[model samples]
Target: MKRLPLEGIRVADLTMVWAGPFATKILAEMGAEVIKVESPQAWDLVRTLIPMPGVEEFWNCSYYFNDYNRDKKSVTLHLADPRGRELFLRLVERSDVVIENYRADVLDKLGLGYEVLRERKRDIILVSMAGFGKTGPEREYVGYGPIIEQMAGLASLTGYGDDGVPYKTGISYGDPVAGAAAAGAVALALIRRQRTGEGAFIDLAQREVMATLIGEAFVRASLRGEVPPHRGNRDERYAPQGVYRCFGEDRWVAISVRSDEEWRRLAQAIGRPDLASLTLPERKARHDELDRAIEAWTEQIRPQVAAQVLQAVGVPAAPVIDTEAIHDDPNLVAREFWVTLPHPRMKPWRQPRSPWRLAEANPTPRRHAPLFGEHNTEILGGLLGLSQEEIAELEAAGIVGRAPVDARPGG
Candidate 1:
């Protein structure tokens, strides 16, 4: 088999929920061995967030969990316990990278901070993703994706102009954005390590990274003490840009008329040739009117068909694809965005493969998520040189186990 870019990398992933797991998923897709350590005492909350009615191993069956956790091994360990700490450190000593998304204080409190991990293995790269940074004033504030959006000023920038209130995205958009950057951070740290033979401690703030996307807004803030005005989907640079509703149930098309030529092309395409020669400034001044005009034409057509019509005439347009529709999108399918893998406990569903498609070294998912501690004997005994009796002793001592005792989905 042709080796992938990250084929030799091993990561001890202690992240739960979206941000951390999303990053590890990318690494796994790029051909890294990811050991996901969880605990019976307080497992990943997402495992039980939406449990199926009577499924026994609901944790292993979650679409959300499995989506991000594919191609990794799950190992249950209580890090608060001394034995768990010792075992985790043992794993860390052998791991090339360690990732966590716990609160700023959690890792150090667990006695597994970057300094301590570096002591165990001098060149161990550590990526810590807190909502804020470890040393910021906002570090202690509890933040999920929505909170991150608000804190990062993204929410303030998203809303219909008529409404004074800001609107949050329908989904937790911050998680995946931060996750993608974290994956890149891990790769950069590895590259730096290759040059210097030293490890890096990456302090990634979720809100800060989310804020970086709007750097021009920061310049506006500093130069003129300006806060961005909410223009809904409209951009300051592009006039007559918005998402318009189409014929079907909640279907919409996003259109951006960048130049006078695009506006004329779109106008002609939509049979509004009388309004074809409107300049950018004129379009900007009458954006809402233009939106209504566009929607009038679009409401009679399917979003996909409308987008294609606009695109055929050189307008930048696309359908606002929803979850189910996106899975069936021909472009994404042509790009091979989705994949299905068999799992022993669950039937196959569409899961997104990594977007980082390396042409020469194409990485593919090798296995479903490992059954809880499925490689205990192989990893602890074979890799760590523990004798069979010693392994038995460790299991007997509550140092390791396949499943969590008294484990409910989240419990």
Candidate 2:
């Protein structure tokens, strides 16, 4: 295999939940050695977010945790303990990057801030992904992805115009967006270190990253003093654009007419040839009536069939695939976008391949997410040159463990 871009890089991952794990996963895909450090007393919450009923080691078997955490090693360490902190700093002395998404105060409180890390390894890159940045007034506030969306103004732009209400996206939209940005930031930081031999402190605010998505909305508010009105799925540039229900239960197809020519084609495709000559203004005026007519035709066909017929006539259309149907999507299947890796505790299931396709390097997932403390010996003994007796002593003292200290049903 060709050498991946981040080959030979070592990262100490001090993140949990979606955003941090998602960022580390991208780095791991690019060939970084990501050691996920979790304290035995306080492990990643996602491990037990949806525990499998009556299953042994349910934390290790969580599909939610396994999906985002593949291609990384797990190391249990109680950072609050002096020995664990010493070991972590020793690990940091040999690592290229240290990343965490704790609140702005947590790292300093743990005595592992960038200044302390730089003392151990002067050229180490520290990427802090706090919900708000370290210097902001809101830096002390805690926030998740949904809260980030609302604070970033994304929620304000996401409702139907008629409802006078705002809606957050169905998924935790801010998380992956910030994760992708943080991964890119890490790459850039590495490049800077190579060029200037200087370390960097990247203070990334997740809310700021989410706000970047609505740049046009900010421009409108600033330049025209206009708040962006919600149009739901409708685009201002396109008329008669909406997602309509199809024949199957809960199945829908999204259709858009960008031009008069496409509108003509769409009208003909929907068997409303009489409406083909309507101009853009006329179409805009009658979008509701057109939607009703389009639905009258669409409700008789399956979403896929409706998408195909409309697409055949050059009107932009696609089926709004739900969670289950997405796994069977033909386009994704043809592109080999999913892979099913063997897991020790769970049956093989399709997981998404890295979307960052490097034609030559061909990054692929090498292993499943590690079981708790799976790499404690490999890292502490093999890398740090600790003796077996020393490791056993640490484990006995509750500085490291094979499982959480007080495991419960819900994490």
Candidate 3:
């Protein structure tokens, strides 16, 4: 097999929750060695975010935690402890990168700031994913993905016109966006370091990354001094574009008629032959009537069938696959987009493969997320050259553990 791009790269992952872990996940998929460090006193909260009923070691069994954390190793180290801090710095001296998504003041409070890491390893790449960045006026403010979206002005643009209430996406939209950006930043920093022989500190604000996605909104506001009106699923440019209900309960298909020809095709596909010649302005004026006509035809068929009929007639259409049904999506199945990996704690289930498919390198997930601190002995003894007695001492002192000291029923 060909070598992956990050085959020799090593990443010290100190990120918890979604944003930082998502970024390191990409690196791991591309063949980087990602060592996820969590404190025994306060391990990643996601481990117990949703505790499984009647399950021992529920932390290791969390599907939410395992899904985002596959292809990585776990090490327990309480940074607040002086011995643990020293051990982490020792690890840093041999690592190529250290990434974290703490609040702006947290790293410095623990005395493991960029400057400290730089002293340990001169060429260590530090990627700090603070929610608002380190230098801004709101740097000290704490936030998560939902708050990031509202603060970034994304939520302001996502509401139905009638209700006048902004709606956040069903998922945490800002996290994965920032994660992808952070991964790219890591690649760019690696390139620059190769040329300059210097490390980099990437101060990525999640809100800033989220805000960049709405550039067109900014441009329109700056030029015309107008806030874009909430249009729900309707697009001003594409008349008669909306999600319509299909036959099954809560099943829907989204249809967009971009060009006049496409609109004509869509009209005929829904058995409205007389409306095929309607102009753009006419369609815009009668969008409600067209939607009713479209839904009448759509409600008679399954979402997939409705989508297939419209798409076959040259109209842009797609069925909205829900969480459960998405697992059986034909296109994804054909592309082998999901892999089922064995886990020590959980049963094998289909998990998403890396979306970044390099035809030559063929990067694949190597293992499930490590059992809590599963690699402690391997890393401390093999990689860091610690003696068995020394590791045992650390464990006896509650400095390292296989389970969280603060573990409870739910996180």
Residue-pair clashes per candidate:
0, 0, 0
**In model 1, which runs have C-alpha deviations exceeding 4 angstroms?**
387-398, 405-411
Q: What residue runs in model 3 are displaced by over 4 Å at the alpha carbon?
A: none
Per-candidate local distance difference test: 0.85, 0.93, 0.92
1-411: candidate 3 lDDT, tens digit per residue = 589999899999999999999999999999999999999997889999885667899889888889889999999998999999999999999889999999999999999999999999999999999999998799998879999999999998999888789999999999999999999999999999999999999999999999999999999999999898899999989988999999989999999999999988887888888899999999999989999999999999999999888888889999998999999998999998889999878889999999888879887788999889999998888899999999999999988888988687677
Q: Model 2 over residues 254-317: C-alpha lDDT tens digits?
A: 9999999999898888899999999989988998999999999999999999999988888899
Query: What range of 10 consecutive residues in model 2 has the weakest lDDT sum?
Result: 402-411
Error of 2 at 146 (Å): 0.2
Judging by lDDT, tell me the better candidate of 2 and 3. 2
Query: Could you tell me which residue pairs clash in candidate 2?
Result: none
Off by over 4 Å in 2: none
Kindly list the per-residue Cα lDDT of model 1 for residues 1-411, writing each as its tens digit: 367888889999999889999999999988888888887666777766665557887766667677778899877677988878988899998899999999999999999998899899999999999999888688876568998888888887888768678999898888999999999999999999999999999999999989998788888999999888888788999989989999989999999988888899999988899989889888889987888899999999999899888888889999998888889988889988888889887888887776666778777666776666777777777666678898677677666776565666644
TM-score of every candidate relative to the true structure: 0.93, 0.98, 0.98
RMSD of each: 2.1, 1.0, 1.1
Q: Compared to the true structure, candidate 1 yields what TM-score? A: 0.93
Top model by lDDT, which number?
2
Q: Candidate 1: deviation at residue 353, Å?
A: 1.3
The full ranking of all candidates by lDDT, starting with the best, is 2, 3, 1
